[model samples]
Target: MSVSAYKRVQRDLESPRSVERRIFNRITADLETWGAAYDRAESKADRLSALKGSLQLALVDNTRLWSLLRRDLSQPENALPPELRAAIISISYTVDRITADLMSGAGTVAALVGINRPFIDGLAGISGAEG
Candidate 1:
Protein backbone atom coordinates (compact mmCIF):
# COMPACT_ATOMS: atom_id res chain seq x y z
CA MET A 1 0.00 0.00 0.00
CA SER A 2 1.02 3.63 -0.50
CA VAL A 3 2.34 5.60 2.47
CA SER A 4 -0.73 7.83 2.50
CA ALA A 5 -3.07 4.85 2.61
CA TYR A 6 -1.08 3.31 5.43
CA LYS A 7 -1.05 6.60 7.30
CA ARG A 8 -4.81 6.85 6.85
CA VAL A 9 -5.21 3.46 8.52
CA GLN A 10 -2.93 4.56 11.31
CA ARG A 11 -4.93 7.74 11.78
CA ASP A 12 -8.11 5.77 12.08
CA LEU A 13 -6.46 3.43 14.54
CA GLU A 14 -5.05 6.33 16.57
CA SER A 15 -8.45 7.52 17.62
CA PRO A 16 -8.60 5.91 21.03
CA ARG A 17 -12.21 6.82 21.67
CA SER A 18 -13.29 5.36 18.36
CA VAL A 19 -11.52 2.11 19.05
CA GLU A 20 -12.85 1.99 22.59
CA ARG A 21 -16.35 2.73 21.42
CA ARG A 22 -16.21 -0.09 18.94
CA ILE A 23 -14.96 -2.48 21.58
CA PHE A 24 -17.64 -1.36 23.99
CA ASN A 25 -20.30 -1.84 21.34
CA ARG A 26 -19.10 -5.37 20.73
CA ILE A 27 -19.11 -6.17 24.42
CA THR A 28 -22.56 -4.65 24.82
CA ALA A 29 -23.93 -6.77 22.02
CA ASP A 30 -22.31 -9.84 23.51
CA LEU A 31 -23.80 -9.11 26.88
CA GLU A 32 -27.24 -8.62 25.40
CA THR A 33 -27.02 -11.86 23.51
CA TRP A 34 -25.69 -13.69 26.53
CA GLY A 35 -28.46 -12.30 28.69
CA ALA A 36 -31.12 -13.46 26.32
CA ALA A 37 -29.53 -16.84 26.00
CA TYR A 38 -29.27 -17.18 29.75
CA ASP A 39 -32.93 -16.43 30.29
CA ARG A 40 -33.82 -19.01 27.73
CA ALA A 41 -31.07 -21.45 28.57
CA GLU A 42 -31.82 -25.17 28.36
CA SER A 43 -28.70 -26.16 30.27
CA LYS A 44 -25.95 -24.73 32.44
CA ALA A 45 -23.42 -25.36 29.71
CA ASP A 46 -25.57 -23.43 27.32
CA ARG A 47 -25.39 -20.36 29.51
CA LEU A 48 -21.69 -20.85 30.10
CA SER A 49 -21.23 -21.21 26.39
CA ALA A 50 -22.90 -17.87 25.79
CA LEU A 51 -20.72 -16.25 28.43
CA LYS A 52 -17.67 -17.88 26.92
CA GLY A 53 -18.61 -16.60 23.52
CA SER A 54 -18.95 -13.13 25.00
CA LEU A 55 -15.56 -13.46 26.60
CA GLN A 56 -13.99 -14.56 23.35
CA LEU A 57 -15.36 -11.62 21.42
CA ALA A 58 -14.38 -9.24 24.20
CA LEU A 59 -10.83 -10.51 24.10
CA VAL A 60 -10.66 -10.45 20.32
CA ASP A 61 -11.94 -6.88 20.01
CA ASN A 62 -9.88 -5.31 22.79
CA THR A 63 -6.64 -7.08 21.95
CA ARG A 64 -6.88 -6.05 18.30
CA LEU A 65 -7.57 -2.48 19.40
CA TRP A 66 -4.73 -2.38 21.88
CA SER A 67 -2.41 -3.83 19.29
CA LEU A 68 -3.42 -1.00 17.01
CA LEU A 69 -2.70 1.49 19.77
CA ARG A 70 0.73 0.00 20.40
CA ARG A 71 1.47 0.42 16.69
CA ASP A 72 -0.02 3.91 16.52
CA LEU A 73 1.93 5.26 19.49
CA SER A 74 5.19 4.69 17.63
CA GLN A 75 4.16 6.83 14.71
CA PRO A 76 4.02 10.55 14.02
CA GLU A 77 1.31 12.43 15.82
CA ASN A 78 -1.00 15.38 15.43
CA ALA A 79 -2.96 17.12 18.18
CA LEU A 80 -5.08 14.67 20.13
CA PRO A 81 -7.83 15.28 22.65
CA PRO A 82 -6.58 15.33 26.22
CA GLU A 83 -9.12 12.72 27.31
CA LEU A 84 -8.19 10.58 24.34
CA ARG A 85 -4.50 10.86 25.16
CA ALA A 86 -5.14 9.87 28.74
CA ALA A 87 -7.27 6.98 27.61
CA ILE A 88 -4.54 5.83 25.27
CA ILE A 89 -1.93 6.00 27.98
CA SER A 90 -4.16 4.07 30.36
CA ILE A 91 -4.84 1.48 27.67
CA SER A 92 -1.15 1.17 26.92
CA TYR A 93 -0.39 0.60 30.56
CA THR A 94 -3.16 -2.00 30.78
CA VAL A 95 -1.90 -3.85 27.70
CA ASP A 96 1.63 -3.86 29.07
CA ARG A 97 0.40 -5.11 32.43
CA ILE A 98 -1.64 -7.89 30.92
CA THR A 99 1.21 -8.95 28.64
CA ALA A 100 3.59 -9.09 31.54
CA ASP A 101 1.14 -11.09 33.60
CA LEU A 102 0.67 -13.57 30.79
CA MET A 103 4.40 -13.89 30.17
CA SER A 104 4.89 -14.55 33.87
CA GLY A 105 2.16 -17.21 33.83
CA ALA A 106 0.30 -15.32 36.55
CA GLY A 107 -2.92 -14.87 34.62
CA THR A 108 -5.25 -16.66 32.27
CA VAL A 109 -7.27 -15.66 29.22
CA ALA A 110 -10.35 -15.47 31.45
CA ALA A 111 -8.64 -12.74 33.44
CA LEU A 112 -7.78 -10.59 30.44
CA VAL A 113 -11.12 -10.16 28.73
CA GLY A 114 -11.87 -6.46 29.21
CA ILE A 115 -12.29 -3.68 31.76
CA ASN A 116 -15.88 -4.56 32.56
CA ARG A 117 -15.37 -7.70 34.57
CA PRO A 118 -17.83 -6.58 37.17
CA PHE A 119 -20.48 -6.06 34.53
CA ILE A 120 -19.71 -9.48 33.14
CA ASP A 121 -19.90 -11.01 36.56
CA GLY A 122 -23.26 -9.39 37.11
CA LEU A 123 -24.47 -10.79 33.84
CA ALA A 124 -23.26 -14.18 34.88
CA GLY A 125 -25.03 -13.86 38.20
CA ILE A 126 -28.25 -13.04 36.45
CA SER A 127 -27.77 -16.12 34.35
CA GLY A 128 -27.89 -18.23 37.55
CA ALA A 129 -24.30 -18.98 38.55
CA GLU A 130 -20.73 -18.36 37.48
CA GLY A 131 -20.40 -21.79 35.81
Candidate 2:
Protein backbone atom coordinates (compact mmCIF):
# COMPACT_ATOMS: atom_id res chain seq x y z
CA MET A 1 0.00 0.00 0.00
CA SER A 2 0.98 3.63 -0.47
CA VAL A 3 2.62 5.45 2.41
CA SER A 4 -0.22 7.94 2.80
CA ALA A 5 -2.84 5.16 3.05
CA TYR A 6 -0.67 3.31 5.53
CA LYS A 7 -0.28 6.44 7.63
CA ARG A 8 -4.05 6.98 7.64
CA VAL A 9 -4.57 3.41 8.77
CA GLN A 10 -2.01 3.89 11.52
CA ARG A 11 -3.76 7.04 12.70
CA ASP A 12 -7.13 5.30 12.68
CA LEU A 13 -5.67 2.60 14.87
CA GLU A 14 -4.15 4.99 17.42
CA SER A 15 -6.50 7.97 17.43
CA PRO A 16 -9.07 7.95 20.21
CA ARG A 17 -11.52 10.04 18.19
CA SER A 18 -11.55 7.43 15.46
CA VAL A 19 -11.85 4.72 18.04
CA GLU A 20 -14.85 6.42 19.63
CA ARG A 21 -16.49 6.88 16.24
CA ARG A 22 -16.04 3.21 15.50
CA ILE A 23 -17.55 2.27 18.82
CA PHE A 24 -20.56 4.47 18.21
CA ASN A 25 -21.00 3.12 14.70
CA ARG A 26 -20.81 -0.42 15.97
CA ILE A 27 -23.40 0.24 18.64
CA THR A 28 -25.72 1.92 16.18
CA ALA A 29 -25.46 -1.00 13.81
CA ASP A 30 -26.20 -3.43 16.58
CA LEU A 31 -29.33 -1.53 17.60
CA GLU A 32 -30.55 -1.46 14.04
CA THR A 33 -29.96 -5.17 13.66
CA TRP A 34 -31.82 -5.97 16.83
CA GLY A 35 -34.71 -3.79 15.81
CA ALA A 36 -34.89 -5.61 12.51
CA ALA A 37 -34.82 -8.92 14.31
CA TYR A 38 -37.77 -7.85 16.42
CA ASP A 39 -39.65 -6.83 13.34
CA ARG A 40 -39.02 -10.20 11.73
CA ALA A 41 -39.99 -12.05 14.85
CA GLU A 42 -43.29 -10.25 14.88
CA SER A 43 -44.19 -11.93 11.60
CA LYS A 44 -43.49 -15.40 12.93
CA ALA A 45 -45.94 -17.86 14.55
CA ASP A 46 -44.06 -17.91 17.84
CA ARG A 47 -42.96 -14.28 18.04
CA LEU A 48 -43.25 -14.09 21.79
CA SER A 49 -41.19 -17.22 22.19
CA ALA A 50 -38.61 -16.07 19.66
CA LEU A 51 -38.53 -12.59 21.06
CA LYS A 52 -38.08 -13.70 24.65
CA GLY A 53 -34.84 -15.49 23.95
CA SER A 54 -33.28 -13.07 21.48
CA LEU A 55 -34.68 -10.03 23.21
CA GLN A 56 -33.11 -11.07 26.46
CA LEU A 57 -29.80 -11.62 24.74
CA ALA A 58 -29.94 -8.26 23.01
CA LEU A 59 -31.02 -6.41 26.14
CA VAL A 60 -28.28 -8.04 28.13
CA ASP A 61 -25.72 -6.87 25.59
CA ASN A 62 -27.17 -3.37 25.63
CA THR A 63 -27.01 -3.25 29.42
CA ARG A 64 -23.42 -4.39 29.37
CA LEU A 65 -22.58 -1.61 26.96
CA TRP A 66 -24.37 0.91 29.14
CA SER A 67 -22.52 -0.38 32.18
CA LEU A 68 -19.19 0.16 30.48
CA LEU A 69 -20.20 3.63 29.35
CA ARG A 70 -21.31 4.53 32.85
CA ARG A 71 -18.02 3.32 34.27
CA ASP A 72 -16.05 5.40 31.78
CA LEU A 73 -18.12 8.53 32.31
CA SER A 74 -17.77 8.22 36.07
CA GLN A 75 -14.00 8.42 35.84
CA PRO A 76 -12.13 11.60 36.89
CA GLU A 77 -10.31 12.25 33.59
CA ASN A 78 -13.16 11.75 31.16
CA ALA A 79 -12.83 15.26 29.68
CA LEU A 80 -16.61 15.74 29.29
CA PRO A 81 -18.30 18.27 31.50
CA PRO A 82 -19.71 17.13 34.83
CA GLU A 83 -23.27 17.92 33.85
CA LEU A 84 -23.05 15.93 30.65
CA ARG A 85 -21.51 13.03 32.47
CA ALA A 86 -24.28 13.06 35.00
CA ALA A 87 -26.90 13.22 32.30
CA ILE A 88 -25.41 10.27 30.47
CA ILE A 89 -25.18 8.25 33.65
CA SER A 90 -28.77 9.10 34.34
CA ILE A 91 -29.76 7.93 30.89
CA SER A 92 -27.95 4.67 31.49
CA TYR A 93 -30.04 4.10 34.57
CA THR A 94 -33.19 4.75 32.56
CA VAL A 95 -32.00 2.20 30.04
CA ASP A 96 -31.50 -0.32 32.81
CA ARG A 97 -34.99 0.29 34.12
CA ILE A 98 -36.53 0.06 30.67
CA THR A 99 -34.61 -3.12 30.00
CA ALA A 100 -36.05 -4.66 33.15
CA ASP A 101 -39.53 -3.66 32.11
CA LEU A 102 -39.08 -5.24 28.67
CA MET A 103 -37.75 -8.45 30.15
CA SER A 104 -40.77 -8.60 32.41
CA GLY A 105 -43.24 -8.31 29.44
CA ALA A 106 -44.23 -4.79 30.39
CA GLY A 107 -42.26 -2.90 27.75
CA THR A 108 -41.15 -2.98 24.14
CA VAL A 109 -37.85 -2.87 22.29
CA ALA A 110 -39.03 0.38 20.77
CA ALA A 111 -38.39 2.16 24.03
CA LEU A 112 -34.86 0.95 24.35
CA VAL A 113 -34.15 1.67 20.69
CA GLY A 114 -35.58 5.16 20.93
CA ILE A 115 -33.57 6.08 24.02
CA ASN A 116 -30.33 4.99 22.39
CA ARG A 117 -30.86 6.99 19.18
CA PRO A 118 -29.23 10.14 20.53
CA PHE A 119 -26.17 8.24 21.56
CA ILE A 120 -25.72 7.06 17.99
CA ASP A 121 -26.29 10.51 16.52
CA GLY A 122 -24.36 12.49 19.12
CA LEU A 123 -21.41 10.18 19.17
CA ALA A 124 -21.24 9.85 15.38
CA GLY A 125 -21.65 13.60 14.81
CA ILE A 126 -24.81 13.21 12.79
CA SER A 127 -26.87 16.32 13.10
CA GLY A 128 -29.78 14.95 11.09
CA ALA A 129 -30.13 11.24 10.59
CA GLU A 130 -33.32 11.42 8.59
CA GLY A 131 -31.74 13.30 5.74
Candidate 3:
Protein backbone atom coordinates (compact mmCIF):
# COMPACT_ATOMS: atom_id res chain seq x y z
CA MET A 1 0.00 0.00 0.00
CA SER A 2 1.44 3.24 -1.20
CA VAL A 3 0.56 6.45 0.57
CA SER A 4 -1.54 7.65 -2.34
CA ALA A 5 -3.33 4.36 -2.49
CA TYR A 6 -4.03 4.44 1.23
CA LYS A 7 -7.00 6.69 0.70
CA ARG A 8 -8.16 4.64 -2.23
CA VAL A 9 -7.96 1.51 -0.14
CA GLN A 10 -9.83 3.25 2.58
CA ARG A 11 -12.42 4.32 0.06
CA ASP A 12 -12.79 0.77 -1.14
CA LEU A 13 -13.55 -0.46 2.35
CA GLU A 14 -16.53 1.83 2.44
CA SER A 15 -18.27 -0.11 -0.30
CA PRO A 16 -18.34 -3.34 1.69
CA ARG A 17 -17.02 -6.91 2.24
CA SER A 18 -13.71 -8.43 1.11
CA VAL A 19 -11.61 -8.64 4.26
CA GLU A 20 -13.64 -6.33 6.47
CA ARG A 21 -15.81 -9.03 8.03
CA ARG A 22 -12.99 -11.18 9.32
CA ILE A 23 -11.21 -8.17 10.70
CA PHE A 24 -14.35 -6.85 12.34
CA ASN A 25 -15.01 -10.22 13.94
CA ARG A 26 -11.51 -10.27 15.25
CA ILE A 27 -11.87 -6.77 16.64
CA THR A 28 -15.16 -7.58 18.34
CA ALA A 29 -13.69 -10.69 19.91
CA ASP A 30 -10.63 -8.81 21.02
CA LEU A 31 -12.71 -6.04 22.59
CA GLU A 32 -14.74 -8.60 24.50
CA THR A 33 -11.58 -10.15 25.77
CA TRP A 34 -10.16 -6.77 26.65
CA GLY A 35 -13.28 -5.81 28.57
CA ALA A 36 -13.13 -9.05 30.49
CA ALA A 37 -9.45 -8.59 31.13
CA TYR A 38 -10.09 -5.12 32.42
CA ASP A 39 -12.71 -6.53 34.72
CA ARG A 40 -10.29 -9.11 36.06
CA ALA A 41 -7.48 -6.63 36.69
CA GLU A 42 -8.00 -6.40 40.45
CA SER A 43 -4.60 -4.94 41.14
CA LYS A 44 -5.11 -2.28 38.49
CA ALA A 45 -8.73 -1.51 39.34
CA ASP A 46 -8.21 2.17 39.83
CA ARG A 47 -6.24 2.57 36.67
CA LEU A 48 -8.66 0.46 34.67
CA SER A 49 -11.67 2.38 35.91
CA ALA A 50 -10.06 5.69 35.13
CA LEU A 51 -9.61 4.61 31.51
CA LYS A 52 -12.33 2.01 31.38
CA GLY A 53 -15.00 4.37 30.13
CA SER A 54 -12.92 5.33 27.16
CA LEU A 55 -12.06 1.71 26.66
CA GLN A 56 -15.71 0.80 26.80
CA LEU A 57 -16.58 3.49 24.29
CA ALA A 58 -13.93 2.17 21.98
CA LEU A 59 -15.28 -1.31 22.51
CA VAL A 60 -18.81 -0.23 21.61
CA ASP A 61 -17.51 1.56 18.58
CA ASN A 62 -15.70 -1.60 17.59
CA THR A 63 -18.91 -3.56 17.98
CA ARG A 64 -20.90 -1.16 15.85
CA LEU A 65 -18.10 -0.98 13.33
CA TRP A 66 -17.75 -4.73 13.30
CA SER A 67 -21.46 -5.13 12.68
CA LEU A 68 -21.06 -3.08 9.54
CA LEU A 69 -17.94 -4.92 8.45
CA ARG A 70 -19.32 -8.36 9.11
CA ARG A 71 -22.37 -7.73 6.96
CA ASP A 72 -19.93 -6.92 4.19
CA LEU A 73 -17.40 -9.66 4.96
CA SER A 74 -20.02 -12.36 4.65
CA GLN A 75 -20.20 -11.38 1.01
CA PRO A 76 -16.52 -12.05 0.22
CA GLU A 77 -12.93 -10.96 0.80
CA ASN A 78 -12.92 -9.27 4.13
CA ALA A 79 -10.62 -8.41 6.81
CA LEU A 80 -4.84 -3.65 14.81
CA PRO A 81 -2.27 -1.93 17.16
CA PRO A 82 -1.48 0.58 20.01
CA GLU A 83 -1.13 -0.07 23.74
CA LEU A 84 -4.51 0.85 22.52
CA ARG A 85 -3.56 3.67 20.22
CA ALA A 86 -1.33 1.65 17.95
CA ALA A 87 -3.96 -1.04 18.06
CA ILE A 88 -6.59 1.34 16.68
CA ILE A 89 -4.55 2.47 13.68
CA SER A 90 -3.47 -1.04 12.87
CA ILE A 91 -7.06 -2.24 12.87
CA SER A 92 -8.24 0.72 10.82
CA TYR A 93 -5.64 0.13 8.11
CA THR A 94 -6.43 -3.55 7.76
CA VAL A 95 -10.16 -2.88 7.58
CA ASP A 96 -9.66 -0.09 5.07
CA ARG A 97 -7.89 -2.40 2.69
CA ILE A 98 -10.47 -5.08 2.96
CA THR A 99 -13.27 -2.59 2.55
CA ALA A 100 -11.56 -1.08 -0.48
CA ASP A 101 -11.41 -4.45 -2.17
CA LEU A 102 -15.07 -4.97 -1.46
CA MET A 103 -15.79 -1.54 -2.87
CA SER A 104 -14.50 -2.80 -6.19
CA GLY A 105 -17.96 -4.39 -6.45
CA ALA A 106 -16.79 -7.93 -7.14
CA GLY A 107 -18.53 -9.74 -4.29
CA THR A 108 -22.10 -10.82 -3.64
CA VAL A 109 -22.34 -9.90 0.03
CA ALA A 110 -21.47 -6.31 -0.60
CA ALA A 111 -25.07 -5.16 -0.52
CA LEU A 112 -25.65 -6.60 2.90
CA VAL A 113 -23.55 -4.03 4.70
CA GLY A 114 -24.02 -0.31 4.36
CA ILE A 115 -20.51 0.95 4.94
CA ASN A 116 -20.14 4.23 3.17
CA ARG A 117 -17.01 6.19 2.27
CA PRO A 118 -17.63 8.57 5.14
CA PHE A 119 -17.69 5.73 7.63
CA ILE A 120 -14.30 4.52 6.53
CA ASP A 121 -12.87 8.01 6.65
CA GLY A 122 -14.39 8.49 10.07
CA LEU A 123 -12.75 5.30 11.25
CA ALA A 124 -9.43 6.53 9.91
CA GLY A 125 -9.84 9.84 11.63
CA ILE A 126 -10.81 8.17 14.87
CA SER A 127 -7.86 5.85 14.64
CA GLY A 128 -5.51 8.73 13.98
CA ALA A 129 -6.78 10.48 17.07
CA GLU A 130 -5.99 7.42 19.13
CA GLY A 131 -2.63 6.95 17.48
**Alpha-carbon local distance difference test for all models:** 0.54, 0.71, 0.45
> Whose TM-score is higher: candidate 1's or candidate 3's?
1
Q: Estimate the TM-score of every prediction.
A: 0.36, 0.69, 0.30
Poorly placed runs, candidate 1 (over 4 Å): 1-20, 28-54, 81-87, 95-131
Worst 10 residues of 2 by lDDT: 42-51
Residue by residue across 43-88, what tens digits does model 2's lDDT show? 4444445456555667777888889889999999999999999999
After the best TM-score superposition of candidate 3, give how far the Cα of residue 40 lies from its true spot, in angstroms. 2.4
User: After TM-score superposition, what is the CA distance of residue 77 in candidate 3 from its true location, in Å?
Assistant: 21
Better model by lDDT: candidate 1 vs candidate 2: 2
Q: Candidate 2 at residue 96, lDDT?
A: 93
Report the CA-based lDDT of candidate 1 relative to the real structure. 0.54
